[model samples]
Target: METMRVIDKIRQLIPPLSPGYHKGQAGRVCVIGGSDEYTGAPYFSSFSALKLGADMAFVVCQPTAAVAIKSYTPGIN
Candidate 1:
């Protein structure tokens, strides 16, 4: 199926997970977006990067959105 092919490609791109790797060795991601009306977008974007094996994720957003984004998770920068 098409989905299976996509999954296979993704697996090929991701390096093997290993304890020998240090932080930031996996990857780093930066998401830029957020506003008074749409704060969750950036938060989810950055969070998704982390969930997908990124070691660090940073978000750039308005001050108001920054507060909400930070509240969502301390794991993100």
Candidate 2:
């Protein structure tokens, strides 16, 4: 059996960022989850993508939950 470091695996899977790349050239992600009873899960998923170099992250939840999610922060759309 053999093991590889997480960073090594990630580096092999993701392409390097190029200086000439423009917005969204890296990637875009959409997280769909959460509801009136649970909202943080969706927010965490969407924000996680943005933190990982995603150009944009969107969350699709119930209408009522949308308002709650949007109010939580301006970081995600």
Candidate 3:
């Protein structure tokens, strides 16, 4: 029940998608956490944002992590 309430609250906060809305008008998400030893978290964070209707997602990470994250998908910048 608590989860349902949280979901409802989030729903209320998100604007309804409209045909007239341009790309990125909905939302943009940036995830800033990654290291050579741990790149999955940041990649997942950015990917989740895109999956959840964000128009764009960016990941900031260590150079070594950047390559791994980039290999996951071209969707994230």
List residue ranges in candidate 1 displaced over 4 A.
74-77
Model 3 clashes, total count: 0
| Candidate 2 TM-score, true structure as reference | 0.81
TM-score of each: 0.85, 0.81, 0.83
Tens digit per residue, CA lDDT, model 1, 4-71: 99999989988998999888999998899999889889888888998888998889888888888898
lDDT of 2 by residue, 1-77 (tens): 13568768878988888999999889988788888989999988887888888887878889989988998896445
**Per model, how many backbone clashes are there?**
0, 0, 0
lDDT of each: 0.87, 0.84, 0.87
Candidate 2 regions exceeding 4 Å error are: 1-4
Please say which candidate is ahead in TM-score: 1 or 3.
Answer: 1
Ranking by TM-score: 1, 3, 2
